[model samples]
Target: MSSRERVLAAVAGVAGIAAAATLATPGAAASGRYQHWDDTAYRGQIEVVRSADGPSDPTVLNGTVFVDRDRDSRHDRNERGLAGVEVSNGREVATTDSRGRYRLPVYDNMTVFVTQPAGYQVPVDEFNVAQFHYNHLPAGSPDLRYGGIAPTGPIPDAVNFPLVESRLTDDRRLSCIIAGDLQTYDLDEVEYARKGAIADLARRNDYQGCGSLFVGDVVGDDLSLYDEVKGLTAQTNGPARFLPGNHDLDFDATTAEHSFDTFRAQLAPAYFSYDVGNAHIIALNTVRYPCTPELDNADGLRPECDDPVNRPRYNGAIDATQLEWLRRDLAKVDRDKLIVIAGHIGLLNWADEGSAIHQVDQVREVYSLLHGRKAVALAGHSHSIENLRTGDSMQGWRDLFGVQSLPFPHLTVGAIAGDWYSGQVTEAGYPTALQRDGGRPGVLTLDLHDSSFQERFTVTGESDRVQTQLGLNSPTYREWYVARSAWNRNPVGAAPELGDPLVVDQADLAGGTWLTTNVFMGATGSTVTVRLDDGRPRAAVRTQAMQGEDQLVGPEWSDPVAVAEQLVHGGSVADRTMHLWRFALPADLSPGTHRAHVTATDIHGRRFTDSLTFRVVASR
Candidate 1:
């Protein structure tokens, strides 16, 4: 039964069939922290009145109002004064006086929500914080299917807003499910990340349009499982965005700006930026534990060589005021449009084997401040699965800023705990063989479509199957199986066979490790070799260039079955988790059913081939 007794019997069968009045209390869990609120604990005063029967009259919409008594949209101080609570503006609805104040009636693309009241719970921001709906339109909204509130026509007298009661929103483009480190600090690795990747994002529907971005450690040091990671982002399918890793900070805070003050007060934007659609999405914090007093070694002194909490430091660096607010948010974007840049480390890598601080020093000054149009950078502290591409490496920053390489794409996106969530647990309840570079435990589905962008690697409950590439072992079978993989400790069972239907007699591929793939936008020269259907004559093995920690030079090792069939034809793992790759057939080949052809070449080079048939047999 263990996996922490099936996650404590699935949190005691979800608190004995859900609704313990919708659990939260404890002063709304100390007002959930509003992504770290400090706009000066907000005073109160609201009044956007105008419902005398339409055509404007009860006009009185001033502004600044936030208390949300634990409604969960984020605004604290033990969230009190809900007096009459009831706010709206999509048309009209008001209440909240006797100090809890309210007077609603305004519109310019209105959306002033607050209808959360069961056993009370609203307020979030240090990452546990939620509540955001006040778009104020000027001239947008008509793309339907959940893109709402853009049209800027009328309805505005005194449009004021300061709410604390929330369910989370901002006119909606939302479904942000990014997922990286579910680190898990026990409870059988949080039921092996809840039956391998939150039970497939809780029985999916294509992320329902913007809600999921685990992007950090989430627990691992056990901050009391932040309420069991908000009950696993409320069993997902939407709404859950958190960022902060170096193991989700708080090495007992005390300073270092209080190390994410308990996660900015529960998560909203330690660095922040959002747009969706034509895409913009930035989210950085980069782990900066400053701590002075000559770097307090708890007073024993002698620390400070740029104190990141007296150093154990993870790689990648950013601060300088978030690189000057990412150089004025990439100068208000539009270098033809398409920037993504998420974080947790990773700007360019052969998976940190070259470790210039685990990647991201100047990154060519941020790829010359992203001057060469079309971008897509994501990270997840190497839990593994690289994707790489574009001249395959000079170590990112688009080749340290002289630019060139990306004519238009970049990625790293892999880890829903594929490795940290480890292995062993099959009956399809999940978790079996996820060492990463080989793929599995997924999420990464970009699709921009205007300034051009495409990426897919969705695997968790086999949502159709998109995995780009990963197939290891070469280097003359690592010097003919490094001492029988240290006497069968299993270096992927010491492979090397190229005989029988597996004939590749002499391309002598020297000492190998990395072999990745995923190419679509127009592909190129794509000749991903390795074909053996007998007829005996194998030859494409050269060396020098791809180095170690399990080699495979970049662009996600050039082609792992064409990036796992473009992440299973781009449904992005239909929901999340499950994508595998593990090549090891060289023990001197001579068994049965062989065939493993994978070819691709486009950008007018045009060529395609896909085949997979296995059955080595004959061991005893």
Candidate 2:
């Protein structure tokens, strides 16, 4: 049969695959422009009773979590208080009593927030930002560049939190979106993001309840852009939540306590938790800015951190106070629920698998806390898509963090601003923005049923159908890579692109040539198989085994498809990835045009198929 016939056959075969039926959901299907919830739709807020003389007892703060029957931000006499709700002062977890009233010891500077319980939701402002927290910084933060938090004078008389009932939040089946690094440096980049992922999210209403948790780096160094970035979230169909990144820090703050004050003022609590369905999502503040030698384990490992005066580097760490809070927070959660531990920096990741500063320093301790619980960690500092499953290990994880292997899956959800939004601009109104792992910019959706979930990644303007990228790794491509990579470093002129990537000569087949498959979310137990036209299917081996092995990198391990775009245009080179798989071609094959059909079955047992045709000439 001709190559065109084979392509048609492969397309037809995909229709019969049972997994294809489960690809997209009705709520995920693109309707016209989604009508997002405006301010008039839900007007709820925490009732703060302030006094001219302030609270008599400054050490103790009292609050009530009440049912907002009138949809108002007040605690009316008729509206009853909700009991058994969780509240926090950033360090301690407090539960509401029988009457929904609770008292907690107050601190000088802390955010008192209520964890939006299942079956109900906290109030959202104009931008759909959940307003659950009340900052209690009496004197506020010290003088900082970004106007850190303005002085929130003495504690209010009663910080009454108002919550509204919602059937969406109570559903057993939930879809939670984990988006990383919107990281817009300027308004132009913001527009790129608006047209890309934000636009895609705006069209879907599936995640209206669980909403979108933007992991970190909301804006590049400009905290001034927080307002602009929050405006983009208004277009999305759900409540938008956030955690702070190194970029989101108020750099002028000399003390670490006030580093993220401005971020908390604009976005969310630095660390907080909420419940939806059977999932308990915990957003942690993992970035420790201006990490000095004074901190434990920072003396010798990081040189940039030595000079807090000039360098002022950030490290992936959880402070003692926050760690204590985590223990208290977990104590209140039911072990049956799925615990999603999210942060800006990964607890452990493939990109920085060996680096001590990039991965969280307290990973081992955090693991011990969730020892027997069902949990999954999600992060996005590295700008790579990593689906590291249970028992997956790297040399760095064992060496630095003392973690032998992952007890639970830790996923580095790829960034919204892919590779800092670099590469060629596409007609879709955004840059191609290919990631460091060769994965396209996308958001991760955890479709949960009870406590279990199936993770799916939807590319920014593409459907879930687009998952894998196909490429041929020939001996000739390697030679071009070395030459062009050097030229990219020190460009003399326009660097030449890879020539005839699909055409392999006799030398290429003899030396080494194979078909490479880059599965964006491939994890352990995931399998890739390649079938030549009319031939039996052969198994493809994963490049990085992720079983206590050091990272394997170089031209031989690179994705030719991603390298071509990065070297010619602009983006991080996809030199190493845990999700790459390859199938070696036989050297004894006759020279002719050939077609290969590739099928990748993920750990969730969902299968995705793609086909590529290449020419095998007798000689170059």
Global lDDT of each model?
A: 0.46, 0.85
Off by over 4 Å in 1: 1-62, 70-130, 142-196, 200-234, 237-239, 242-400, 403-437, 443-620
Error of 2 at 366 (Å): 0.4
lDDT of candidate 1 vs native? 0.46
Clash counts per candidate, in order, are 98, 0
- State, as a TM-score between 0 and 1, how close model 1 is to the true structure: 0.32
Worst 10 residues of 1 by lDDT: 569-578
Residues 43-95, model 2: lDDT tens digits: 55678988888778889899899999898799999988899999999888999
Per-model TM against the reference: 0.32, 0.94
The runs of at least 3 residues in candidate 2 whose Cα sits more than 4 Å from the true structure, single-residue gaps closed, are 1-41, 296-299
Model 2 earns a TM-score of 0.94
